[model samples]
Target: MVFADGTERPCGGLLVPVTLHQRTGLAAQLGAALAAPTPLTAEGLATPKMPGETSVRGLFVAGDATGQMPSVANVIASGSTTASAIVGRLTGAT
Candidate 1:
Protein backbone atom coordinates (compact mmCIF):
# COMPACT_ATOMS: atom_id res chain seq x y z
CA MET A 1 0.00 0.00 0.00
CA VAL A 2 1.09 3.55 -0.71
CA PHE A 3 0.95 6.00 2.08
CA ALA A 4 0.24 9.71 1.74
CA ASP A 5 3.95 10.40 1.98
CA GLY A 6 4.57 8.17 -1.08
CA THR A 7 6.12 5.34 0.90
CA GLU A 8 4.93 1.90 -0.23
CA ARG A 9 4.22 -1.19 1.84
CA PRO A 10 4.58 -4.55 0.20
CA CYS A 11 1.73 -7.04 0.06
CA GLY A 12 1.12 -10.55 -1.17
CA GLY A 13 -0.02 -12.03 -4.47
CA LEU A 14 0.11 -10.31 -7.86
CA LEU A 15 -1.48 -7.24 -6.46
CA VAL A 16 0.00 -3.94 -7.47
CA PRO A 17 0.88 -1.26 -4.99
CA VAL A 18 -2.28 0.53 -3.93
CA THR A 19 -2.20 4.21 -4.65
CA LEU A 20 -4.70 6.62 -6.13
CA HIS A 21 -2.32 7.75 -8.82
CA GLN A 22 -1.23 4.27 -9.78
CA ARG A 23 -4.73 2.90 -9.74
CA THR A 24 -6.10 5.76 -11.80
CA GLY A 25 -3.18 5.54 -14.17
CA LEU A 26 -3.72 1.81 -14.60
CA ALA A 27 -7.40 2.35 -15.21
CA ALA A 28 -6.70 4.92 -17.88
CA GLN A 29 -4.00 2.88 -19.56
CA LEU A 30 -5.95 -0.36 -19.56
CA GLY A 31 -9.12 1.32 -20.72
CA ALA A 32 -7.34 2.99 -23.56
CA ALA A 33 -5.42 -0.12 -24.52
CA LEU A 34 -8.52 -2.31 -24.48
CA ALA A 35 -10.84 0.37 -25.82
CA ALA A 36 -12.99 -0.20 -22.76
CA PRO A 37 -14.51 2.31 -20.46
CA THR A 38 -13.12 2.82 -16.98
CA PRO A 39 -15.91 4.34 -15.04
CA LEU A 40 -14.69 6.66 -12.31
CA THR A 41 -16.20 7.70 -9.08
CA ALA A 42 -16.68 11.30 -8.05
CA GLU A 43 -13.29 11.11 -6.37
CA GLY A 44 -11.72 10.07 -9.69
CA LEU A 45 -11.12 6.52 -8.57
CA ALA A 46 -12.06 3.73 -10.94
CA THR A 47 -15.33 2.09 -10.09
CA PRO A 48 -15.34 -1.66 -9.68
CA LYS A 49 -17.49 -3.99 -11.83
CA MET A 50 -18.14 -6.41 -8.98
CA PRO A 51 -16.94 -9.47 -10.91
CA GLY A 52 -13.89 -7.59 -12.16
CA GLU A 53 -14.91 -8.12 -15.77
CA THR A 54 -14.84 -5.33 -18.27
CA SER A 55 -16.76 -4.54 -21.45
CA VAL A 56 -13.80 -5.75 -23.44
CA ARG A 57 -14.06 -9.44 -24.06
CA GLY A 58 -11.33 -11.47 -22.37
CA LEU A 59 -10.25 -8.43 -20.42
CA PHE A 60 -10.56 -8.49 -16.67
CA VAL A 61 -9.78 -6.17 -13.77
CA ALA A 62 -9.10 -7.13 -10.19
CA GLY A 63 -7.19 -6.23 -7.04
CA ASP A 64 -6.26 -2.60 -6.53
CA ALA A 65 -7.09 -1.86 -10.12
CA THR A 66 -10.78 -2.32 -9.30
CA GLY A 67 -10.66 0.68 -6.97
CA GLN A 68 -12.39 -1.27 -4.27
CA MET A 69 -11.02 -1.40 -0.77
CA PRO A 70 -7.23 -1.59 -0.99
CA SER A 71 -6.94 -4.44 1.44
CA VAL A 72 -5.03 -7.65 0.95
CA ALA A 73 -8.03 -9.83 1.68
CA ASN A 74 -10.25 -7.97 -0.74
CA VAL A 75 -7.60 -8.08 -3.44
CA ILE A 76 -7.10 -11.80 -3.03
CA ALA A 77 -10.82 -12.47 -3.11
CA SER A 78 -11.30 -10.34 -6.19
CA GLY A 79 -8.44 -12.07 -7.98
CA SER A 80 -9.84 -15.47 -7.03
CA THR A 81 -13.32 -14.64 -8.25
CA THR A 82 -12.07 -13.21 -11.50
CA ALA A 83 -9.74 -16.13 -12.03
CA SER A 84 -12.57 -18.57 -11.52
CA ALA A 85 -14.63 -16.83 -14.13
CA ILE A 86 -11.75 -16.84 -16.58
CA VAL A 87 -11.01 -20.50 -15.96
CA GLY A 88 -14.65 -21.36 -16.36
CA ARG A 89 -14.70 -19.66 -19.70
CA LEU A 90 -11.50 -21.31 -20.88
CA THR A 91 -12.56 -24.78 -19.75
CA GLY A 92 -16.18 -24.37 -20.83
CA ALA A 93 -17.19 -24.98 -17.26
CA THR A 94 -19.58 -22.62 -15.61
Candidate 2:
Protein backbone atom coordinates (compact mmCIF):
# COMPACT_ATOMS: atom_id res chain seq x y z
CA MET A 1 0.00 0.00 0.00
CA VAL A 2 0.96 3.67 -0.33
CA PHE A 3 1.03 6.37 2.27
CA ALA A 4 -0.32 9.86 1.73
CA ASP A 5 3.15 11.04 0.88
CA GLY A 6 3.45 8.33 -1.80
CA THR A 7 5.72 6.11 0.26
CA GLU A 8 5.38 2.35 -0.02
CA ARG A 9 4.40 0.21 2.93
CA PRO A 10 4.21 -3.48 3.72
CA CYS A 11 1.13 -5.44 2.82
CA GLY A 12 -0.11 -9.00 3.50
CA GLY A 13 2.35 -9.23 6.40
CA LEU A 14 5.16 -9.23 3.89
CA LEU A 15 8.15 -6.96 4.29
CA VAL A 16 7.30 -5.72 0.83
CA PRO A 17 4.88 -6.78 -1.81
CA VAL A 18 3.82 -4.67 -4.75
CA THR A 19 4.83 -1.12 -5.52
CA LEU A 20 2.54 1.72 -4.50
CA HIS A 21 1.80 2.38 -8.14
CA GLN A 22 0.19 -1.05 -8.26
CA ARG A 23 -2.42 0.14 -5.83
CA THR A 24 -5.11 2.78 -6.22
CA GLY A 25 -4.41 5.94 -8.17
CA LEU A 26 -5.70 8.23 -5.45
CA ALA A 27 -4.13 9.62 -2.36
CA ALA A 28 -3.39 7.33 0.58
CA GLN A 29 -4.72 4.13 -0.94
CA LEU A 30 -3.20 2.19 1.93
CA GLY A 31 -5.27 4.16 4.41
CA ALA A 32 -8.40 3.32 2.51
CA ALA A 33 -7.57 -0.37 2.30
CA LEU A 34 -6.75 -0.58 6.00
CA ALA A 35 -9.60 1.63 7.11
CA ALA A 36 -12.61 -0.18 8.47
CA PRO A 37 -15.78 0.30 6.52
CA THR A 38 -18.61 1.90 8.45
CA PRO A 39 -21.93 3.51 7.83
CA LEU A 40 -21.63 7.04 6.52
CA THR A 41 -22.07 9.69 9.17
CA ALA A 42 -22.50 13.42 8.92
CA GLU A 43 -19.19 13.89 10.64
CA GLY A 44 -17.51 10.96 8.97
CA LEU A 45 -17.67 10.18 5.28
CA ALA A 46 -19.95 13.14 4.50
CA THR A 47 -17.49 15.95 4.77
CA PRO A 48 -18.43 19.39 3.56
CA LYS A 49 -16.94 21.15 0.60
CA MET A 50 -16.87 24.73 -0.60
CA PRO A 51 -19.89 26.08 -2.38
CA GLY A 52 -19.76 26.81 -6.16
CA GLU A 53 -16.84 24.48 -6.51
CA THR A 54 -17.31 21.78 -9.12
CA SER A 55 -13.74 20.66 -8.51
CA VAL A 56 -10.72 22.35 -7.07
CA ARG A 57 -9.64 24.85 -9.71
CA GLY A 58 -7.34 23.19 -12.22
CA LEU A 59 -7.51 20.05 -10.08
CA PHE A 60 -10.16 17.53 -10.99
CA VAL A 61 -11.34 14.61 -8.90
CA ALA A 62 -12.51 11.45 -10.65
CA GLY A 63 -13.23 7.80 -10.13
CA ASP A 64 -13.98 6.52 -6.65
CA ALA A 65 -12.74 9.75 -5.14
CA THR A 66 -15.74 11.48 -6.66
CA GLY A 67 -18.06 8.75 -5.32
CA GLN A 68 -18.75 7.24 -8.72
CA MET A 69 -19.23 3.52 -9.27
CA PRO A 70 -16.07 1.49 -8.95
CA SER A 71 -14.97 -0.58 -11.94
CA VAL A 72 -12.39 -0.47 -14.70
CA ALA A 73 -14.93 0.94 -17.12
CA ASN A 74 -16.20 3.44 -14.56
CA VAL A 75 -12.70 4.61 -13.79
CA ILE A 76 -11.91 5.07 -17.46
CA ALA A 77 -15.13 6.96 -17.98
CA SER A 78 -14.47 9.13 -14.97
CA GLY A 79 -11.05 10.01 -16.32
CA SER A 80 -12.47 10.96 -19.69
CA THR A 81 -15.26 12.97 -18.11
CA THR A 82 -12.88 14.76 -15.80
CA ALA A 83 -10.59 15.63 -18.67
CA SER A 84 -13.50 16.99 -20.68
CA ALA A 85 -14.83 18.96 -17.74
CA ILE A 86 -11.43 20.47 -17.07
CA VAL A 87 -10.98 21.44 -20.66
CA GLY A 88 -14.42 22.97 -20.87
CA ARG A 89 -14.07 24.80 -17.62
CA LEU A 90 -10.72 26.19 -18.61
CA THR A 91 -12.14 27.25 -21.93
CA GLY A 92 -15.02 29.04 -20.15
CA ALA A 93 -17.71 26.93 -21.78
CA THR A 94 -20.50 24.97 -20.17
Candidate 3:
Protein backbone atom coordinates (compact mmCIF):
# COMPACT_ATOMS: atom_id res chain seq x y z
CA MET A 1 0.00 0.00 0.00
CA VAL A 2 1.04 3.60 -0.52
CA PHE A 3 2.58 5.20 2.53
CA ALA A 4 1.80 8.66 3.86
CA ASP A 5 4.50 10.06 1.61
CA GLY A 6 3.12 8.20 -1.40
CA THR A 7 5.93 5.69 -1.33
CA GLU A 8 4.53 2.35 -2.41
CA ARG A 9 6.05 -0.57 -0.56
CA PRO A 10 5.86 -4.18 -1.59
CA CYS A 11 4.49 -6.41 1.13
CA GLY A 12 6.40 -9.62 0.54
CA GLY A 13 5.20 -13.25 0.79
CA LEU A 14 2.29 -13.04 -1.59
CA LEU A 15 -0.21 -11.56 0.81
CA VAL A 16 -1.88 -9.57 -1.94
CA PRO A 17 -1.17 -9.20 -5.59
CA VAL A 18 -0.41 -5.71 -6.90
CA THR A 19 -1.66 -4.31 -10.15
CA LEU A 20 0.43 -1.77 -12.00
CA HIS A 21 -1.94 0.89 -13.23
CA GLN A 22 0.48 3.39 -14.71
CA ARG A 23 3.97 2.66 -15.95
CA THR A 24 5.44 5.70 -14.25
CA GLY A 25 9.16 6.12 -13.61
CA LEU A 26 8.78 5.15 -10.01
CA ALA A 27 6.78 2.07 -10.92
CA ALA A 28 9.51 1.05 -13.34
CA GLN A 29 12.05 1.41 -10.57
CA LEU A 30 9.98 -0.72 -8.18
CA GLY A 31 9.57 -3.34 -10.92
CA ALA A 32 13.32 -3.51 -11.35
CA ALA A 33 13.83 -3.83 -7.62
CA LEU A 34 11.40 -6.76 -7.48
CA ALA A 35 12.96 -8.38 -10.53
CA ALA A 36 16.28 -8.74 -8.73
CA PRO A 37 14.89 -11.80 -6.90
CA THR A 38 16.82 -10.89 -3.79
CA PRO A 39 15.12 -11.11 -0.44
CA LEU A 40 13.30 -7.89 0.41
CA THR A 41 14.88 -6.02 3.26
CA ALA A 42 13.18 -4.74 6.42
CA GLU A 43 14.77 -1.35 6.05
CA GLY A 44 11.54 0.52 5.44
CA LEU A 45 9.24 -1.33 7.79
CA ALA A 46 8.58 1.62 10.10
CA THR A 47 5.20 3.30 9.89
CA PRO A 48 4.97 6.79 8.42
CA LYS A 49 3.06 8.66 11.05
CA MET A 50 1.50 12.06 10.82
CA PRO A 51 3.18 15.04 12.45
CA GLY A 52 2.77 14.83 16.25
CA GLU A 53 3.42 11.96 18.63
CA THR A 54 5.37 8.81 17.81
CA SER A 55 2.12 6.93 17.24
CA VAL A 56 -1.54 7.82 17.02
CA ARG A 57 -2.96 8.17 20.54
CA GLY A 58 -5.03 5.28 21.87
CA LEU A 59 -4.16 3.36 18.73
CA PHE A 60 -1.62 0.70 19.60
CA VAL A 61 0.40 -0.93 16.85
CA ALA A 62 0.68 -4.62 15.98
CA GLY A 63 2.13 -6.89 13.34
CA ASP A 64 5.36 -6.38 11.41
CA ALA A 65 6.47 -2.96 12.52
CA THR A 66 5.42 -3.75 16.06
CA GLY A 67 7.18 -7.11 15.86
CA GLN A 68 3.94 -8.95 16.53
CA MET A 69 3.31 -11.02 13.38
CA PRO A 70 4.58 -11.09 9.82
CA SER A 71 1.91 -12.98 7.95
CA VAL A 72 -0.91 -11.20 6.14
CA ALA A 73 -3.67 -12.96 8.06
CA ASN A 74 -1.91 -12.21 11.32
CA VAL A 75 -1.59 -8.57 10.43
CA ILE A 76 -5.28 -8.39 9.58
CA ALA A 77 -6.18 -9.98 12.90
CA SER A 78 -3.83 -7.66 14.76
CA GLY A 79 -5.44 -4.67 13.10
CA SER A 80 -8.85 -5.88 14.26
CA THR A 81 -7.53 -6.37 17.76
CA THR A 82 -5.94 -2.95 17.72
CA ALA A 83 -9.23 -1.43 16.71
CA SER A 84 -10.95 -3.21 19.55
CA ALA A 85 -8.30 -2.03 21.96
CA ILE A 86 -8.70 1.54 20.76
CA VAL A 87 -12.46 1.39 21.23
CA GLY A 88 -12.05 -0.11 24.66
CA ARG A 89 -9.58 2.56 25.65
CA LEU A 90 -11.88 5.25 24.38
CA THR A 91 -14.82 3.82 26.32
CA GLY A 92 -12.70 3.45 29.47
CA ALA A 93 -13.26 -0.30 29.47
CA THR A 94 -9.67 -1.36 29.08
Candidate 4:
Protein backbone atom coordinates (compact mmCIF):
# COMPACT_ATOMS: atom_id res chain seq x y z
CA MET A 1 0.00 0.00 0.00
CA VAL A 2 1.27 3.41 -0.92
CA PHE A 3 0.42 6.54 0.99
CA ALA A 4 0.12 9.87 -0.77
CA ASP A 5 3.70 10.59 0.26
CA GLY A 6 5.06 7.64 -1.79
CA THR A 7 5.97 5.52 1.20
CA GLU A 8 5.22 1.82 1.05
CA ARG A 9 3.09 0.53 3.86
CA PRO A 10 3.89 -2.81 5.48
CA CYS A 11 1.84 -5.53 3.79
CA GLY A 12 1.94 -7.82 6.79
CA GLY A 13 -0.47 -10.64 7.43
CA LEU A 14 -0.75 -13.95 9.26
CA LEU A 15 0.38 -15.94 6.17
CA VAL A 16 0.75 -13.21 3.59
CA PRO A 17 4.29 -14.26 2.78
CA VAL A 18 3.24 -17.90 2.32
CA THR A 19 0.47 -19.92 0.81
CA LEU A 20 -3.06 -19.08 2.05
CA HIS A 21 -3.39 -15.27 1.98
CA GLN A 22 -4.15 -12.93 4.83
CA ARG A 23 -7.85 -12.52 4.13
CA THR A 24 -10.49 -12.91 1.50
CA GLY A 25 -8.80 -12.02 -1.79
CA LEU A 26 -11.84 -11.78 -4.02
CA ALA A 27 -10.79 -8.48 -5.55
CA ALA A 28 -7.18 -9.49 -5.99
CA GLN A 29 -8.14 -12.85 -7.44
CA LEU A 30 -10.96 -11.61 -9.66
CA GLY A 31 -8.97 -8.70 -11.15
CA ALA A 32 -12.18 -6.70 -11.64
CA ALA A 33 -14.90 -4.99 -9.68
CA LEU A 34 -18.41 -4.41 -10.99
CA ALA A 35 -20.58 -1.71 -9.53
CA ALA A 36 -23.97 -0.38 -10.59
CA PRO A 37 -26.71 1.55 -8.86
CA THR A 38 -29.20 -1.09 -9.98
CA PRO A 39 -29.72 -3.89 -12.44
CA LEU A 40 -28.74 -2.64 -15.89
CA THR A 41 -31.64 -1.84 -18.16
CA ALA A 42 -31.71 -2.44 -21.87
CA GLU A 43 -32.51 0.41 -24.18
CA GLY A 44 -35.97 -0.52 -25.45
CA LEU A 45 -39.69 -0.32 -24.70
CA ALA A 46 -39.55 -3.36 -22.42
CA THR A 47 -36.27 -5.15 -21.78
CA PRO A 48 -35.48 -7.76 -19.21
CA LYS A 49 -32.39 -7.35 -17.09
CA MET A 50 -30.53 -10.55 -16.40
CA PRO A 51 -29.89 -10.53 -12.71
CA GLY A 52 -26.25 -10.95 -11.56
CA GLU A 53 -24.94 -10.11 -15.00
CA THR A 54 -22.40 -7.34 -14.60
CA SER A 55 -21.58 -4.58 -17.08
CA VAL A 56 -18.41 -6.51 -17.84
CA ARG A 57 -19.18 -9.51 -19.93
CA GLY A 58 -18.37 -12.93 -18.40
CA LEU A 59 -17.81 -11.28 -15.05
CA PHE A 60 -20.34 -11.07 -12.24
CA VAL A 61 -20.62 -10.36 -8.52
CA ALA A 62 -23.14 -10.53 -5.70
CA GLY A 63 -23.74 -9.63 -2.05
CA ASP A 64 -22.71 -6.31 -0.52
CA ALA A 65 -20.70 -5.07 -3.48
CA THR A 66 -23.61 -6.05 -5.67
CA GLY A 67 -26.01 -3.91 -3.63
CA GLN A 68 -27.69 -7.01 -2.24
CA MET A 69 -28.18 -8.22 1.28
CA PRO A 70 -24.94 -8.02 3.21
CA SER A 71 -25.75 -10.79 5.59
CA VAL A 72 -23.38 -13.78 5.77
CA ALA A 73 -26.09 -16.11 4.54
CA ASN A 74 -26.84 -13.80 1.62
CA VAL A 75 -23.19 -13.64 0.71
CA ILE A 76 -22.86 -17.41 0.72
CA ALA A 77 -26.06 -17.84 -1.26
CA SER A 78 -25.05 -15.26 -3.82
CA GLY A 79 -21.64 -16.80 -4.35
CA SER A 80 -23.11 -20.25 -4.71
CA THR A 81 -25.78 -19.02 -7.11
CA THR A 82 -23.29 -17.12 -9.22
CA ALA A 83 -20.95 -20.09 -9.35
CA SER A 84 -23.79 -22.32 -10.42
CA ALA A 85 -24.76 -19.86 -13.11
CA ILE A 86 -21.24 -19.75 -14.43
CA VAL A 87 -21.04 -23.53 -14.48
CA GLY A 88 -24.36 -23.78 -16.28
CA ARG A 89 -23.21 -21.32 -18.87
CA LEU A 90 -19.99 -23.21 -19.43
CA THR A 91 -21.66 -26.60 -19.61
CA GLY A 92 -24.53 -25.30 -21.74
CA ALA A 93 -27.02 -26.46 -19.17
CA THR A 94 -30.51 -25.03 -19.38
Candidate 5:
Protein backbone atom coordinates (compact mmCIF):
# COMPACT_ATOMS: atom_id res chain seq x y z
CA MET A 1 0.00 0.00 0.00
CA VAL A 2 1.21 3.50 -0.79
CA PHE A 3 0.88 6.17 1.89
CA ALA A 4 0.87 9.93 1.79
CA ASP A 5 4.41 10.04 3.17
CA GLY A 6 5.69 8.34 0.03
CA THR A 7 6.05 5.01 1.78
CA GLU A 8 5.10 1.76 0.10
CA ARG A 9 4.52 -1.78 1.20
CA PRO A 10 4.48 -5.03 -0.74
CA CYS A 11 1.94 -7.75 -0.18
CA GLY A 12 1.33 -11.12 -1.80
CA GLY A 13 -1.82 -13.09 -2.60
CA LEU A 14 -4.16 -10.12 -2.38
CA LEU A 15 -7.42 -11.55 -3.68
CA VAL A 16 -10.00 -9.30 -2.18
CA PRO A 17 -12.53 -6.94 -3.70
CA VAL A 18 -12.37 -3.67 -1.86
CA THR A 19 -15.17 -1.23 -2.42
CA LEU A 20 -14.50 2.37 -1.56
CA HIS A 21 -17.25 3.98 0.47
CA GLN A 22 -17.94 7.60 1.20
CA ARG A 23 -17.78 7.34 5.00
CA THR A 24 -14.16 6.26 4.79
CA GLY A 25 -13.05 9.24 2.70
CA LEU A 26 -12.18 12.89 3.26
CA ALA A 27 -15.65 14.19 2.47
CA ALA A 28 -17.03 13.39 5.89
CA GLN A 29 -13.99 14.86 7.53
CA LEU A 30 -14.19 18.07 5.52
CA GLY A 31 -17.90 18.52 6.18
CA ALA A 32 -17.42 18.07 9.89
CA ALA A 33 -14.44 20.37 9.88
CA LEU A 34 -16.38 23.08 8.12
CA ALA A 35 -19.32 22.56 10.48
CA ALA A 36 -21.68 22.15 7.54
CA PRO A 37 -25.17 20.81 7.93
CA THR A 38 -24.51 17.38 6.52
CA PRO A 39 -27.28 14.96 7.19
CA LEU A 40 -27.21 11.22 6.74
CA THR A 41 -29.43 9.85 4.02
CA ALA A 42 -31.57 6.75 4.23
CA GLU A 43 -28.84 4.85 2.45
CA GLY A 44 -26.37 5.95 5.11
CA LEU A 45 -24.65 8.50 2.91
CA ALA A 46 -23.90 11.94 4.27
CA THR A 47 -25.57 14.46 2.01
CA PRO A 48 -25.80 18.20 2.09
CA LYS A 49 -28.90 20.21 1.27
CA MET A 50 -31.15 18.64 -1.37
CA PRO A 51 -30.34 21.33 -3.88
CA GLY A 52 -26.67 20.51 -3.44
CA GLU A 53 -26.07 23.45 -1.15
CA THR A 54 -24.65 23.86 2.33
CA SER A 55 -25.65 25.86 5.39
CA VAL A 56 -23.13 28.55 4.53
CA ARG A 57 -24.34 30.82 1.79
CA GLY A 58 -22.42 30.56 -1.47
CA LEU A 59 -20.82 27.33 -0.27
CA PHE A 60 -22.20 24.55 -2.41
CA VAL A 61 -21.54 20.82 -2.30
CA ALA A 62 -22.21 17.92 -4.64
CA GLY A 63 -21.64 14.22 -5.20
CA ASP A 64 -18.65 12.67 -3.48
CA ALA A 65 -17.65 16.07 -2.16
CA THR A 66 -20.77 15.82 -0.03
CA GLY A 67 -20.25 12.18 0.94
CA GLN A 68 -22.83 10.96 -1.54
CA MET A 69 -22.73 7.65 -3.34
CA PRO A 70 -19.84 7.59 -5.78
CA SER A 71 -21.64 7.20 -9.07
CA VAL A 72 -21.65 9.01 -12.39
CA ALA A 73 -25.38 9.69 -12.29
CA ASN A 74 -25.24 11.13 -8.78
CA VAL A 75 -22.36 13.37 -9.72
CA ILE A 76 -24.14 14.65 -12.79
CA ALA A 77 -27.39 15.24 -10.97
CA SER A 78 -25.71 17.00 -8.08
CA GLY A 79 -23.62 19.13 -10.36
CA SER A 80 -26.59 20.10 -12.52
CA THR A 81 -28.71 20.98 -9.52
CA THR A 82 -26.00 23.04 -7.90
CA ALA A 83 -25.13 24.77 -11.12
CA SER A 84 -28.74 25.75 -11.74
CA ALA A 85 -28.99 27.21 -8.26
CA ILE A 86 -25.83 29.21 -8.77
CA VAL A 87 -27.02 30.48 -12.13
CA GLY A 88 -30.36 31.50 -10.72
CA ARG A 89 -28.66 33.46 -7.98
CA LEU A 90 -26.22 35.10 -10.36
CA THR A 91 -28.98 36.07 -12.79
CA GLY A 92 -31.18 37.35 -10.00
CA ALA A 93 -33.96 34.91 -10.96
CA THR A 94 -34.95 34.16 -7.37
Candidate 6:
Protein backbone atom coordinates (compact mmCIF):
# COMPACT_ATOMS: atom_id res chain seq x y z
CA MET A 1 0.00 0.00 0.00
CA VAL A 2 2.92 2.31 0.64
CA PHE A 3 6.41 2.68 -0.73
CA ALA A 4 9.66 3.47 1.06
CA ASP A 5 9.43 7.05 -0.31
CA GLY A 6 6.16 7.50 1.62
CA THR A 7 3.91 7.51 -1.41
CA GLU A 8 0.74 5.49 -1.85
CA ARG A 9 0.76 2.75 -4.48
CA PRO A 10 -2.69 3.72 -5.79
CA CYS A 11 -4.08 0.30 -4.98
CA GLY A 12 -3.33 -1.02 -8.45
CA GLY A 13 -5.68 -3.89 -7.58
CA LEU A 14 -3.20 -4.91 -4.94
CA LEU A 15 -5.28 -3.83 -1.97
CA VAL A 16 -6.76 -6.63 0.12
CA PRO A 17 -9.98 -6.69 2.10
CA VAL A 18 -9.54 -7.53 5.77
CA THR A 19 -12.11 -7.83 8.53
CA LEU A 20 -11.79 -7.11 12.24
CA HIS A 21 -12.13 -10.80 13.10
CA GLN A 22 -9.40 -11.68 10.64
CA ARG A 23 -7.01 -8.99 11.78
CA THR A 24 -4.63 -9.15 14.72
CA GLY A 25 -1.79 -7.27 16.38
CA LEU A 26 -1.04 -3.53 16.13
CA ALA A 27 -1.07 -3.37 12.34
CA ALA A 28 -4.26 -5.43 12.19
CA GLN A 29 -6.11 -3.25 14.65
CA LEU A 30 -7.28 0.27 13.88
CA GLY A 31 -4.64 2.88 14.54
CA ALA A 32 -5.24 6.37 15.88
CA ALA A 33 -4.83 9.27 13.51
CA LEU A 34 -1.53 10.97 14.24
CA ALA A 35 0.11 14.14 13.04
CA ALA A 36 2.50 16.81 14.27
CA PRO A 37 0.67 19.15 16.64
CA THR A 38 2.15 22.17 14.94
CA PRO A 39 4.65 23.29 12.33
CA LEU A 40 8.26 23.98 13.27
CA THR A 41 8.61 26.93 15.64
CA ALA A 42 10.90 29.90 15.00
CA GLU A 43 13.68 27.72 16.28
CA GLY A 44 12.21 25.46 13.67
CA LEU A 45 13.15 21.80 13.85
CA ALA A 46 16.83 21.38 14.60
CA THR A 47 16.76 18.46 16.95
CA PRO A 48 15.20 17.25 20.20
CA LYS A 49 13.28 20.43 21.01
CA MET A 50 11.99 23.66 19.55
CA PRO A 51 13.83 26.96 20.19
CA GLY A 52 12.93 26.64 23.88
CA GLU A 53 9.23 26.70 23.37
CA THR A 54 7.11 27.09 20.32
CA SER A 55 5.76 30.50 19.21
CA VAL A 56 2.98 29.61 21.62
CA ARG A 57 3.86 29.56 25.29
CA GLY A 58 2.89 26.71 27.60
CA LEU A 59 2.87 24.50 24.52
CA PHE A 60 5.52 21.81 24.38
CA VAL A 61 6.44 18.92 22.13
CA ALA A 62 7.53 15.33 22.47
CA GLY A 63 7.80 12.17 20.37
CA ASP A 64 7.58 12.83 16.66
CA ALA A 65 8.03 16.58 17.03
CA THR A 66 11.64 16.03 17.97
CA GLY A 67 12.26 13.85 14.90
CA GLN A 68 14.15 11.28 16.90
CA MET A 69 12.89 7.98 18.21
CA PRO A 70 9.33 7.08 17.13
CA SER A 71 8.51 4.18 19.38
CA VAL A 72 5.36 4.25 21.52
CA ALA A 73 7.31 3.88 24.75
CA ASN A 74 9.79 6.57 23.74
CA VAL A 75 6.96 8.97 22.95
CA ILE A 76 5.40 8.30 26.32
CA ALA A 77 8.71 9.05 28.01
CA SER A 78 9.14 12.22 25.97
CA GLY A 79 5.65 13.37 26.93
CA SER A 80 6.38 12.79 30.60
CA THR A 81 9.61 14.72 30.38
CA THR A 82 8.00 17.55 28.42
CA ALA A 83 5.16 17.74 30.91
CA SER A 84 7.62 18.07 33.76
CA ALA A 85 9.50 20.80 31.92
CA ILE A 86 6.28 22.70 31.34
CA VAL A 87 5.22 22.35 34.94
CA GLY A 88 8.58 23.57 36.15
CA ARG A 89 8.51 26.54 33.78
CA LEU A 90 5.01 27.43 34.91
CA THR A 91 5.81 27.18 38.62
CA GLY A 92 9.11 29.06 38.24
CA ALA A 93 10.99 25.98 39.32
CA THR A 94 12.97 25.64 36.08
Give the Cα lDDT of each candidate: 0.58, 0.44, 0.43, 0.50, 0.57, 0.47
Candidate 3 lDDT, 26-70, residue by residue in tens: 423333221112133222122234211113343345444333335
Stretches off by above 4 angstroms in model 5 are 1-50
Per-candidate clashes, comma-separated: 0, 0, 0, 0, 0, 0
Better of 3 and 6 by lDDT: 6
Tens digits of lDDT, candidate 6, 27-90: 1122322223332221112222332243344555565454444468977887788777887888
lDDT of 1 by residue, 1-94 (tens): 7889999999675643433434345545556233222332222323234375665556677676565665789889989998987887689775
TM-score of each: 0.51, 0.41, 0.38, 0.44, 0.48, 0.42
The alpha-carbon RMSD values of the candidates against the true structure, listed in the order shown, are 10.4, 13.4, 16.1, 12.7, 10.2, 13.4
Predicted candidate 4 versus true structure: per-residue lDDT over 38-77, tens digit per residue: 4321111111134454544566665555555346897788
Ranking by lDDT: 1, 5, 4, 6, 2, 3
Against the true structure, candidate 4 reaches a TM-score of 0.44
By descending TM-score, how would the candidates be arranged? 1, 5, 4, 6, 2, 3
**What overall lDDT, based on C-alpha atoms, would model 6 receive against the true structure?**
0.47
Model 2 agreement with the true structure over 1-94: per-residue lDDT tens digits:
8989999977876453221121343433322222123332111111123211232344455554544334689768767876777677778884
Top model number, TM-score: 1
RMSD in angstroms between candidate 1 and the native structure over all alpha carbons? 10.4
The parts of candidate 3 lying over 4 Å away from their true place are: 1-59
For candidate 3, the lDDT comes to 0.43
Instruction: Give the CA lDDT, 0 to 100, for residue 89 in model 5.
Output: 69
The parts of candidate 6 lying over 4 Å away from their true place are 1-44, 47-57
Candidate 4 clashes between residue pairs 3 or more apart in a chain or in different chains: none
Error of 2 at 64 (Å): 1.7
Clashes counted in candidate 1 amount to 0
**Model 4: runs farther than 4 Å from truth?**
1-49
lDDT of 2: 0.44
